[model samples]
Target: MKAFILDHYKKKGPLRFGDMSEPEVGDDDVLVQVHAAGLNLLDSKIRDGEFKPILPYRPPFILGHDMAGTVIRVGSNVRRFKLGDEIYARPRDGRIGTFAQLIAVNEADVALKPSNLSMEEAASIPLVALTAWQVLVEAAALKKGQKILIHAGSGGVGSFAIQLAKHLGATVATTTSTANIELVKSLGADVIIDYKKQDFETLLTGYDVVLNSLDGDTLQKSLNILKPGGKLISISGPPDPDFAREQGLNWFLRQLLRLLSLKIRRKARRHRVTYAFLFMRANGDQLSKIATLIEDGIIRPVMDKIFPFAAVNEALAYIETGRSRGKVVVKMR
Candidate 1:
């Protein structure tokens, strides 16, 4: 199969289009005919070896994780789907190679595509939507009438986070530049803070949860807006120590994570709140729920741009600008 291959990890490395072996399906996996793939910062980070510690991928590996397509073949163990089923998945790291013409994925990680969206739009939702769903709905268990402050409201995760929070009846407060405030507003953000002009930390308080996806400084500042027992969930670096220890990482890794968490925990305690990192897991059940919401017309997919499959690198470069209103996608089929 012809796929975009990553031969090396470099800051500005390019993806070369070439033929790669077709994936062999496992008894628990299904082979999908690629229709479209979503471009995410994770894709770029993995390409450049930025996530070596958390998600290590060796060189000469195919890249990409977010994808939507049809099931060309299904494993005997897969009972939930059949051949020709329209599905999507955010594949596990080291196993993802959605940039290719086909991908074999675990049935547990794949869900039916939302009826309301096209393949391109469905491709855009998995990674970001799952991140938002897990952090707000699963981890935080946000309640109606509660408030959530979502940073970068116009970005991929933020856009979905805002809408989902609102869907759960939470009051959504989001930060975006003046240019994109309208965009965030359309996505159901109740309060919009122009990040350039307003300091959200100073103006907002009593938030039930802070959905953070930015720098360490911003992470620390997010604690201030929460109520006494509120929680702060960060998807970025620096995992919370308590959770890290519970994960039982190696001694060396645990120690390193401990050092990073000390400062975060201190701030959280000082503000009378909880802090934790959210690494979204791929669950077919949860994704199917999200797809149902989309099919009901309660949520919509937002995409900033679409590049042909061969222009995968160009799409990555465009996303690196961090100015996209929504997802950047790659058309594969």
Candidate 2:
């Protein structure tokens, strides 16, 4: 099978495309023939050794997190799906390799693809959609009549979050550039702050939740927008002690994470707001609900571009520019 392999971790390095052995399916796994894969900053972070402490992946491994494809075979223990089933998933952490021609995903992490979407569209949903879902629906428990601010509204997780927050009946505010103001508006963002022209902290206030996906400085600024008791959930940087405990890191790493996030966590406490870091995990059930939402037209994919499988490196480069309006996909079939 042809796949892109990462031989070593470097700050700026290219993934080498080469042949690799097919995956071995476990009793609780499903073998999928890859049709498309989604590109995410997490992919780049892993490649650059940024997440080495928590997610230590050895070199010479396939790299990708989101995939949509058909099932070529199912493990004997897999009863929910069978051969020919169209599915999509962000395979469980430590088990991801969707950039290849085929992958074996644990059945618990796979979900039936939304019937209304194409393979490329489906591929774009799992990682970003799941991130949004986990933050708004699961972690924050956002309610109607409340207000929530999602940073980088035109990006992958932000785009989906704005729409989902609106669907949950919350008033949505987001930050994006001038070129993407209308893009986030169409996604149902009630308040759009042009990050280039205006600072979001000055414009948004009394919000119930703030979803931060940027650097530590931006994450700190977000605290000012939320009201007392508001939830600040960050998907990026300075993993908190809670996250380290969730990953079951050793005492040394746990204390390290606590110190890393000490500043933001203390600041959030001073403001009387709750703060925590969110690292999205794979869940077939949550994805199934997302499928229903997509099929119902409540949420639609905001795709930036679809590159051929051979252009995987090019796709990663585009995402690194931080200019893509939405998700970037690689067509493998």
Candidate 3:
């Protein structure tokens, strides 16, 4: 198997492309012949070691998490799928190398790919779409007619959030630069704010939910536009105490997380709103539901660029520009 890897953490380190042995499957795992892998900011963060404490990866680790491929081998416990099933997953890290031509993942985290999607498009949805689904639908429970704001409206998660919120009958608002206003609108964002030219806080208010993917400053401001009993869900900084507890951080780290979240949470309480930091988990069942949505034409993948397997490092570099309108994909096979 050929893969891109880095042994040391460097912000600008290059991915070394070379040959490596393919992974072995466990009893509950399935081996996949990789077709396409999605690139995300999470990959860059992992490469830089920003998430080392909670989601540590061993040196010589394979960094890819999102993929779409065909099942080539099924372990004894993998009764849900069969050989040659087209599937997708955001595999738990350090288990499978989606950047390689083959991968093995727990059957619990593998879902059948939407039959209507191309391999490249299927690769783009798992991670970001699940993040949107878990945050808006499961965690926040955003209801019909409720107002919500999705920041970076043309990006990976934003594209999914816009459509999903609309699917649930929520009145969706979103922020993007002028160039992507129409793009966001087409994704069902009822109101589109040009982040560069307009202040969203002033342009809209009384939103029931705000999906904050921007900086800390933007997240704080997002709280201010909410009506009483509103909720703010962040995919950026400002970690939740529950998340820290789930990660089993030590006392000092837990305190640090609480301290960081204190002011914003207090402000949210003052306004009768709830605040939470969203960290999406990989679940094959949730991915299966999202796949059905795609097949039903309720949501669609928004791909910005596709790079050959050898150019994965370039794909990672391109997303760091913080201006990609949609997902960047790596064709692995």
Candidate 4:
């Protein structure tokens, strides 16, 4: 099979396209023929060795997180899906390799694709959509009539979150460039702060939740926007002790994370708001619900571009620019 292989971790290196043997499917896995795959900042970070301490994937591995394709075969235990089923997923962390001609995903991490979407669009949803779903619905438990501020509203996770927050009946506020003001508004953002012209901290207040997906400084600034007893959930972070524990890191790594996040955690406590660092996990059930929203037209994907499979490196470069309005995809079929 032809696949892009990361021979080694380099801060600015590109993946080498090569041939590798097909994957072995487990009893609880499904073998998928790749149709399209999504590009994410996480992919770049992993390639650059940023997640080495935690994720620890050795060199010479395929790299991709989001995918939409057809099930070529299903394991004996996979009763929910079978051959020819259209599916999409962010394969479980240790099992991800969607940037290839085929991948074997654990059945529990795969979901039927939204019937209303194309393979490229479906590929864009799993990672970003799941991030938003985990933050707003699962972690924050956001309620109607409340207000929430989602940073980087034009980005992948931000775009989905703004729409989902509005669907949940919460008033949504978001930060983006002036050029993307209308984009976020169309996604149902009640308040759009042009980051190039205005500061979000000055404009949003008394919010029930603040979803931060920006830099450390931006993460700190987000804490002020939330009201007392509000929640501050950061997907990009100085990982907190809780996240380290969730990943089951060793005592040294756990204490290191605790110390790294100490200042921000203290600040959150001082403001009487709770803080958590969310590292999204794969869940077939959550993706199924997200598929329902897409099929119902409650949430539509906001795509930036789709590159051919041969342009995988180019796709990753585009995402690194931090300029794409939404998700970037690679068509493999």
Model 4: how far residue 40 lies from native, Å:
0.2
Candidate 1 lDDT by residue in tens digits, 253-309: 778888887898888888889888887777888899999999988889999999998
| The 10-residue segment with the lowest total lDDT in model 3 | 92-101
- Displacement of the residue 6 alpha carbon in candidate 3, Å: 2.1
TM-score per candidate, chains pooled: 0.97, 0.99, 0.97, 0.99
**What residue pairs are clashing in model 3?**
none
lDDT of 3 by residue, 89-193 (tens): 999755746788888999999899999999999999999988999999888898998999999999999999999999999998899999998899889888989
RMSD of 2: 0.7
Q: Where is model 3 more than 4 Å wrong at Cα?
A: 94-96
Question: Candidate 2: misplaced stretches above 4 Å?
Answer: none
Note the Cα lDDT for every prediction shown: 0.89, 0.94, 0.89, 0.95
Off by over 4 Å in 4: none
* Residue 121 miss distance in model 1 (angstroms): 0.3
Task: Give candidate 4's whole-model lDDT.
Answer: 0.95
Please give, for residues 1-333, the per-residue lDDT of candidate 2 as tens digits. Answer: 999999999876899999999999999999999999999999999999999999999989999999999999889899999999999999999998999999999999999999999999999999999999999998999999999999999999999999999999999999999999989999999998998899888887899999999998899999998899999999996789889989999999999999999999999999999999999999999999999999999999999999999999899999999999999999995
